[model samples]
Target: MAEERSKVAAIGTFASAADHAECRRLHRRYGTTYYFATQRFPAAIRRRVHALYGFVRVPDEWVDNPAHTNKDAQSRALSDYRAQLLRGLEGVRPEEPALRAFCDVVHEVRMPLEEPLLFLDAMQMDLTVDRYETYRDLRGYMRGSASAVGLMMCAALEAGDDPEMLAAAQALGEAMQLTNFLRDVAEDAARGRIYLPQEDLRSFGVTEDEIFSGVISDRFCNLMKFEIARARALYALADIGIPMLPPCAQKAVQLARVLYSRI
Candidate 1:
């Protein structure tokens, strides 16, 4: 039956990458701005790009998995990811389906060499740095982990290297990250990670316990305002850049950022 064949294909396609599902599952589970924007990509490109996100997500998982493991094993897992990524650059077929799909898109889309590479590089940085003391430190990590993604997505659109466009994209990327940092405060703290800048904490006279409690104090509210304002500014900046892309692409990116801003 045609229906049966369709069902079979869905299961077959999805099952191939079940081990690393967060990336695609995010597409399925949460149709937020990011995923919805992705849906607007060319169908073939969308699938390939989602696969690329999956590969990136798995490395993210190991660091935040909460399964609690020895450092050596975790190190090996990241090293494996680095190896897989490097292999993709050589035009090799990645054994992992996500990598396979990602490779196809990167090659066809001409995504920047550093977008995905820098993301992985940022993940490596995660294993070592848990606290950021300054805005510069945070920006450095965002450059690799978040800005790189924004740049890559633009690359997927074959946009020329317009500095203004790149700046807006990076701002949008950090806005998303800033939102995430607010929501995941408790969980990150559980894993011994604190994304709130040390200076901000000091300025507010808030300690780790105050963050873990989740009770809103005036200081806490003030601190949250600072982060939210940053996200808002980035969203504003992205508006300018979005118009530069194809109209549909611009809409998709707009939708994606708006959806995540809901967080």
Candidate 2:
């Protein structure tokens, strides 16, 4: 009995170690900026952050993969991924390495099950929605894709349920996501998706055709400038939340915020 128990414990230890390594690899490969910023965190918190990135990256890849030509296939794949995540969250070990690691973090932090579910919903939106009519409409999407991520990070840092901190975290998430949209305007247009609000395009006298053509006209430049200003404002708002985090977590969050804004 003792030998059998030892063997079982060894297997569990190996699995946990392997899952954490896989999470780190994924974060390093696809999330260079965020991964680097995580260096500021203590070892335990860094591992959880890596797992979080791995979890988010998997679903994001499902929607954004260039080779995924069929929307139906992508939808089905996303559904399967969501199912696997749900199972993992329910205490079943997920087969996928990233999901396994993420499940461990979820259990550790007691992360809300709804947060990952909401993120999956946003990825599903990418498959069906191609444009936003207004900033308000875009924010609805960000609530899932970005805001949930911030909330998850807060849980990982053990930042507690401070309402003001949560609000600022949401703002930080929006700021980073908006910066990404601006930087990837041409790339996203190539994929037949435009994250920029249609109303803003109209106001700036910019057209979808111009964006598709990669035209850097004064109008397009002006529109980008306006977006940059808006993102900066969010960064300012999010800055207030950093101080609310534990001393160890604050530096990492601040570094990520600064690095994303530089993008």
Candidate 3:
């Protein structure tokens, strides 16, 4: 819990961003310390991370936004959002306010420009495709969406070239994503998004119909238990990467791991 506490401490700094104000607000809405942690980074690193956070906030907004009617609109919005982000990174003023501040972080960190954009690719997967056929499929989604962000953050700390470190960071990111999948199954299905592997559900004698029933059965509980167990495995793998980092950042990562997997 020490690490998670540090993340909580860091999240407190989010309120200071006047320019990327809405992004900060959105971060708060989804559970910041437990979900996104640029605010939870060390003070020296916080602002750049805040920009990363704001950049990330855009793709998330496009997916979770109520205004998105179907796959086409979502894809177009995400495509445009990503392009605008690139322009902002290149020092051009963006039409979107979120990208404006997000670009500042991009310049400040001088991070590998490919990471946050890869994250956009991940969310685009969510908007366009909802059914996962197997663990392999799910893992692919996690890699793009969450693992890419983790690897990029490692780069932010200048660990980009270190394959082992990035691997661990990716594990942590997947763990965080898996936790969200468990907690949000009900909410996700209501919105026509189902991330649980279809094969896993079938193997365990569960069905999509049961999921829609909203009734918690012994089978459903068992299914959740299996999913949580899988997420925990990823958390354990992520733990292998935490100790290699300097203090505050390590603590922040650990904190997010614990809180996100708390259920």
Local lDDT at 173 for model 1: 82
Q: What are the clash counts of all predictions, listed in order?
A: 1, 0, 2
lDDT of each: 0.72, 0.86, 0.71
Residue-by-residue lDDT tens digits, candidate 2, 1-263: 23211111111211378888888998999989999999999999999899899889987887887887799999998888877776665556677888888777777767767777778889999999999999999999999999989988998898999999999999999999999899999888888999999999999999999999999999999999999999999999999999999999999999999888998
Tell me which residue pairs clash in candidate 3: 3-251, 4-255
TM-score of 1: 0.85
lDDT of 3: 0.71
- Candidate 2 at residue 24, lDDT? 93
Give the TM-scores of the predictions, in the order they appear: 0.85, 0.93, 0.85
What lDDT is obtained when candidate 2 is compared to the true structure? 0.86
Q: Show model 2 residue runs off by greater than 4 Å.
A: 1-15
TM-score of 2: 0.93
Off by over 4 Å in 1: 1-23, 30-33
lDDT of 1 by residue, 103-159 (tens): 556666655555676787788888888999977788899998888878777766666
> What value does the lDDT take at residue 151 in candidate 1?
78
